[model samples]
Target: MAKNNGDGKLHVAMLPWLAFGHLIPYLELAKLMATKGHKISFISTPKNIHRLPPIPKTLTPFINFIKIDLPKVKDLPENAESTKDLPFNKVKYLKIANDGLQKPIQDFLKTSSPNWIIYDFATYWLGSLASELGIRTAFFSVFPAVMLGFLGPPNVLIHGDPDNNDNDNTIIIKRPKWVSFETQVRPSLYQLTRWGHYNSDGENMSDVYRLGATVDGCDAVFVRSSFEFEPDWLNLVKRLYKKPVIPVGFLPSTSDTKDDDININNNDSSWLVTKQWLDKQEKGSVVYIAFGSEAKPSQYELTQLALGIELCGLPFYWVLIDQRGASDEEVIKLPIGFEERMCGRGVVCREWAPQFKILSHDSVGGLLIHSGMSSVIQGFQLGKPLVLLPFSAEQDLNATYLVEKKLACMVPRDVDGSFEPESLADSLSLVIVKEEGNMYRDKAKEMMSLFGNRDIQDQCLDELLHFLSTSIK
Candidate 1:
């Protein structure tokens, strides 16, 4: 329970999805609100809450961690509370378990009497539940604004047109009449089929419907984007959703300071070792490669990526999380003599590495990654040019935006969503080794000023606070 300041300060309950990608941004927003003298109840399952980055000691007074047990489902594995714990095929089971949280969450809202509930797409039921309890609800989207615009109106997304026959072969997205800008964010047939399968729970509502209902039912929509980056797309979302669409600027971690300011001794030995390796590399010569937590690359794809990295012949640091069922000895089977051949040029870390620390390193000039929004923001914040190898639909859309904006280069992929080693090597070279790469480097640097602007982010926070205050009253 939050202690009210007696100054009409709002108490906000933050309810994000099971995925860390979604939970982290919600937690960042909660921290921002807490900094503004608001009370925050950061709600999540026990395991998910346990995995969150440490909250600053200063914020402990204003923020409370409320854990609710995740309901068990028959198909979901034990202790699998988030997307990172499961393969892509098992993600739907996580969502099914998430739906079970509604009753416990509703019970909390009834007793807590918070002024507002900030929720994610999967928790659409929270909107109506909050409303029933006389609480305001806001949908905080961790995705880019362009994705919502591309998805079109709630009605359209819920009931897509039967006449439309768009498939994977289409290079350009079929834009709605309201969307004035040209979009190259095309979803492949394979990705769409996977999406369909994920949503094919018998008689249960699809993710699109749930998301649409959440947006339609909420008081306002908050996106983890900046107005400067996607003005047209953001404007289109406002028109399509017919709600107050607020851009909260990329919700970067406030603790992200320069390496010099950080106490290296406080970091673990692995981080120190990685940093030492990075320190040995020349400035702007190393490529930092990570595909985020959720993307599980097939062994074939992993091998292709390894070969591509070798082909590029550049100093690289690759973070590869071990396969779920792989043995310790067979965790990462690289090409024979590959490590020996590339000694001093590449390092493959088979465990979690501090991504922000690596990204902010002076030696890292380029990023090879799946275009998750958090990764995208982190990459742009440090002005690192990108080599995008998107592994999912949202990532593909993000990659398209980066390519269209001239901030990154996307590796050419087959219609089946597979990429050849040669293509990956070429894209990496184009972004890192080629003379023309400077344009991307310059663009990334230019955008850093806007994307990483703390002042603008504070202003956005002010706007959000003002909205919550005025609307709640």
Candidate 2:
């Protein structure tokens, strides 16, 4: 794969995880890289490849898609459409896929090797195999600096202590004393307990450990965040990694794309209709509500949320992905007359929506969100303030990062992973009707200017191409 520099192009490969959140960023990163005249190959399972929207064939002339097969596993559902429909959560599927892709990767490397491979956390387990084949691999962490701190090697080594898993909502984690000036030592006991649940069963604990081990072996590590939001921990991570730890800002570009060509746009003509409705609203008045692809609120909580929106009496658009696996009759149990009440004021849609476009819309002033990283990035980049209702996973940490750091406001959650209506109403009132709301909106705009630059993509692409082509002396 070592072509002469006179040709003036580099070759790179991208392997994203099965989840949509992971896949979207990798696609954006690939697009950015391809803009710099690099040859790109994207590897994924066939099912996921087909799920991608069709891009302009001209824009991706140098790109190719490679599909790898996974072996049959018992008790797994057949013909699972997407990661959401998989029999197990992402962690379990990651391990199985890592083991399954080993042979295919080896064969591909022997025949046609790319200069470098960029991968996500789920595929970290393949680093050693890549190294054994004399290929360099880089790891891209898609979470905030603090969550990355909790997931990085240092935390993993000390995190297994029994006291770390206490049931209290807060845990005090002590960092190196010298770093105390810029850093405050804190551990989220609630988050740890939740992560324990996230990692339990099917050797999930071992898989996370494997993930940390893979990070340790990376040629370089790039986190998709900037130092402005996390000055202290960013410095701490640099010291910890002691390698080329680059802060490439948020890797997703918010530039307007040709959405008419996207495959996911085929369904739900209502989304476009809603866009027209949103355009008619007053600027900075409409609330954009979405709970992400995986977060399915129970009928009870869904009712409360709906009623809360009705009570707030704000113009809003909500993407309610019904994951109850219930029939239409059974789905009627949520909120009494809630749908009928918010009918004109709200536009409620099912399953999928064109989220990026919705977030970027001029009429979207605030977001009622679950704080998933992808949604968080979308909101942050779009300069939209947030009213957080974290469902599960790293969302707790993410919500805390946004609210505690003055990026967004948090709505209350219950002990059983549910939300309340009155509290949500209060949060909405504060974010929408109060002076503090304006302050948050202004801060979000400033942060957006820092992280959501169109130029960072070009810079990242340039660096990646340099790393791929220039031999380290």
lDDT, residue 56, model 2: 49
* Candidate 1 global CA lDDT score: 0.80
Q: Write the per-residue lDDT of candidate 1 for residues 1-473, one digit (tens) a residue.
A: 32344797888999999887888788888888888778899999988887777667888899999999989887788888888777666777778889999889988988898988899999878877788778888999999888888777877666664445563323324555657777766565666664666677774667888888889789899999988889888999999999899998897655542321112133446878888899999998898888877776767778898889898878999877656422112344677888888888988876667788888889997999989888888888888898988776777778888788888898888877678888998888888778978898898899788778899899999998888888873
lDDT of 2: 0.67
Q: Write the residue-wise lDDT of candidate 2 on 175-246 in tens digits.
A: 423344433333344445555665677644454665566577777777777766677667767776666766
TM-scores for every candidate against the unseen true structure: 0.92, 0.86
**Residue 332 CA error for candidate 2 (Å)?**
9.7
Which portions of model 1 miss their true places by more than 4 Å? 1-5, 165-172, 201-204, 256-267, 324-333
Superposed on all Cα atoms, the candidates' RMSDs to the truth, in angstroms, are: 3.4, 3.7
